[model samples]
Target: MPRMNDVGGQDGFGPVIEELDEPPFHADWEAHVMAMNRALIGQGVYNLDEFRDAVERTMSHESSYYENWFRAIQTLLKERGVV
Candidate 1:
């Protein structure tokens, strides 16, 4: 079964626009969210695949990518009783 994030070749999806000069992050909190993901992965708390799966299963399709990352980490931490 296709997960929420697997939109490849799917119809009704809008075009994906690439930003030529997009900033590293649109918000300060986004940077923190990315860092937290990296740190947890490095510490073996969760692998990249696990994070992606959690985000895809847990977050809404309309949620931003960074928001998904934040939600995935929060879910992992709660599962581990770290937060």
Candidate 2:
């Protein structure tokens, strides 16, 4: 019953990695992350470098974007029809 937004996906990016070490189930995860970062930056929420840094610091414990992580991803995917 683990959520997709748990670890950092297989590549330590989206969702947590557990059970096994698998490749990114969806490549769009990266696109979603990038898109979300761009949208947020344009909104003055966070800059490009800031967003990148946040992603780079992602540990197996906490997401740099926090709960907002999943929300942003979900929103973008829904809009892109990639969910």
Among the numbered candidates, top lDDT falls to 1
Clashes of 1: 0
CA deviation > 4 Å runs, candidate 2: 1-26, 59-83
lDDT of each: 0.89, 0.52
TM-score of 2: 0.33
lDDT of 1 by residue, 1-83 (tens): 87887877888977779999999999999999999899989999989998888898888878888988898899988988988
lDDT of 2 by residue, 1-83 (tens): 54443444356356544756655534666557656667867986655565444444332344444344545544544555756
Global lDDT of model 2: 0.52
